[model samples]
Target: MTSPGMSITQLLPDGKLIVLCGRADDASAWQDLLGPARCLAIALDDAPHEARPRTLRGASDHLAWQHHAIGGLDGSGWLAEPADAFDPDHTATLVLPDPLDPPDAGNRRRFGFRRPAWRLFEDKTMVDTLWDAAGVPRAPSIVGDGTADLSVLGAIVDQGTGVVCSCQPRGAGPSAGGDGIWWWREGPPPTTIPTAGPGTWRVRLMPLLEGVPVRLHGLALTTRIIPFPPMELVTLPRPGQGTFLCAGAVPLLDDAADLVTHTERIGVGLRERLGYRGGFSVDGILTPSGFQPTDFNARLTSAMEAAPSDRRVLLHAVNLLAREGNEPDTGAVEQLAEDLFTIGTSCTIFGAATHADDRASRTTSVRWDGDRLVPAPSGAADGRLLITPSPRGWLLTATLATARLPGGGRVGPRAPEIFRVSDEVLGTNFGHLVPPFDTRPSACLPKVALNPEPATR
Candidate 1:
């Protein structure tokens, strides 16, 4: 039975169109999220907000799911009916809320793709300014003006300390280099830190052992450690508490309750600070000290859909779409969430492909192939979860589960996972097509860190 106080409006599918934005959340994830219920999945042709349908997958194919476009609408409540409204060729009209609408703006700011807080939060130099104010734990950080000596970076880490480097524009878009690097005293000597075309990049500092590689991801106040290199120190905040880790690497969050609480706090705090209208994620490190944030993602992140079943992360999706500013009742939400978690009905996020195309970028599938996350090849016919990049980055709108990782890691925090597929390989063997890519971009995303590199998921 649905939880009491759970309004029908909360579960309303009426006029609710679930849209797939990019190669993320292909088909399978869509089916898993929307269930066998009838739905349509449409692909948009443009980037950012210039959304136009390049292809359409119908619901009958088991490949198709419900999708629509919320193009060019501000925060007001004024709705813009497409010029081709009722076009004979089209089956439905495009609907959007006004940007000026209070609830609409609030909702948009809360869940929209552009999250500004992540920028201010992840700046290592900003440590003294914002960390304590946000209720985040404090740690030793080495800051740079982007022009300091790399060896000094090593000194800052001293003996047993980790390093965090923030690289800024060194040259042009693809040519710009780094701002500076951060590390702890225990890490190895500073190696070449790749610079990206001046966008925004942040790194987490931790003790690095000999031959350990550092290929981290995330921007500004949120960064995650790449698990390819084993880590010894990890910290996690108590569940629902205000403190959190900012990095993306999950290996550090070994405790479930701690992860849930800190994650909730980080999620709620970020939404409030950034005026972001979409998804944002904060990565963390579980050190002996506690869960400390390493970095932040202002847009839809890989973690958005990874929560275990009983968590019903779909509620997050629903809440993201609801009127903003009005915080949901924490007590009531906790009660309902507990019920969902107890039933083992959590949500997993996935990505989709255009035409079973192997060129799909980003992590799309999560199944255990002897304990690692090996992404299932994506394509329209494959029925994998679908996701798309908007002006804000990647958006996750679907979900699924694949073979469990070996050992007893538990696929997504627990066993008996949801929507298990037969591992019927789909799409072309594009694994080669997706190069782990130079995350740093300036150094051509730089070759995978020498020692411990990212293990393919």
Candidate 2:
């Protein structure tokens, strides 16, 4: 859905179309309450955010160090600086990756803080408490400080399927995926808690549910939650050891009434109470009993990559706001979201390879900052998703529909024809392919163009 006052258009440069957001969402009510649009503009800057490590919750002035793992978005919508570091007039958006904890009354005064992100989303534990308070159905689990409680886990896993443990820290580190989530293979649970080893580690244990996983998502100030279909997790090992592939995630979320309404209420309630805004997610498992929420994320989620609405929702949120003296069309933004909902089913397939060497560049950078694909200084700042298609191989990063992924499965499926191939062997056919020549241009050979034509020799 678009902002009441904002619209998006495309322009072509060099024969490629570029998407641009024009006009702006009217923010008279927000302005009347908060004063100035700059207060909301703070979310767009990268400097202060990059200078420190930022995650969705439980941040404090005394404890803003970057953590052990980075999140899916590479760290957009985050900040490492203190609440007082940037004035409210300098805030990027209603969302902050490191907004002051909602309970921090002591620090609220530093910014005169009319509209700081009220942090209801401090952590999974905090959310669990809130869900209980709201009488929402949640999966049963235990949290430990990364000390494996084999007895507890074994008992829990034995009751149902198995247990999946998510590391309680945010931010990606070398070879750490989804902050290093681990699943207990089919076996007897361990007898004792494992050592914390080296870093700050904690784990949230959840019993594997029998139902499929689906995502309930929303963005901007609009509370219309869209339930998109669940994505199946696919994995192909790399040379080192990790589920790396032409990663596709069309994580499930579709407009299931029971889940959608609750998600909206929760999302809107959080925004209204905490003044927290921007992209937020609540993932649930679709069981025969009903939808049961198992996870909550207060920032742009990994599933956002699989959601088409994400780009527009983010763009609408960042659209121009009412200046100091202007009057806000109070209901315009709200009405637009309610009436103009238009995001189709989304499926995201990231990490397309344009060359065998492409994997090398991809492994080093955040998923968004691909070497040969992205526009210089990458980010969708101008309302465009990046795609640098080359003759060799093209990198595709998009919020498309479920139909797009899997290259559209077979029509008359007799056990379903496999479209994409994988290998039990890692690094079977991936590596650097450098030309034998010292390819750098110099005085000896300032310019060199190997013939486009194949040589007989």
Kindly list the per-residue Cα lDDT of model 2 for residues 1-457, writing each as its tens digit: 5444333111101121111111122223222223342232222212243444333222121122222111111223233232234433322322222221122222122211223223334355345665675455677777666555644654664445666555554332111123244444356433333346434665666765544344555543433333222332222223222212324334322334444455555555555455544545565555555666665655444443342333434333332221111222435533443333334453334444333333332221112221112222343321122334322244434333333323232111100011111001111132222111111111111111122332110
Residue range 1-457, candidate 1, lDDT tens digits: 5542344224434433333333334333433554434333332223233333334321111111111233332322112222223122333322221110111211221222222344444344453345455566645555544434545654555444334444433221111011243232333433445443223443333332222112122111222111111111111111122111111122211224334444445444443454333334444333333545544433333332244432333434433443233333444443543443331232332322233434544334444454233445553221234444432223333343222224422222221121113111233111211111111111211111111222121
Q: Give the Cα lDDT of each candidate.
A: 0.32, 0.35
User: What local lDDT score does residue 312 receive in model 1, on the 0 to 100 scale?
Assistant: 33
- When summed lDDT is taken over every stretch of 10 residues in candidate 2, the lowest stretch is 414-423
**Model 2 CA lDDT for position 386:** 31
Candidate 1 runs further than 4 Å off: 1-119, 122-128, 168-192, 195-255, 258-281, 297-301, 304-318, 321-323, 327-332, 335-457
- lDDT score for candidate 2 against the true structure: 0.35
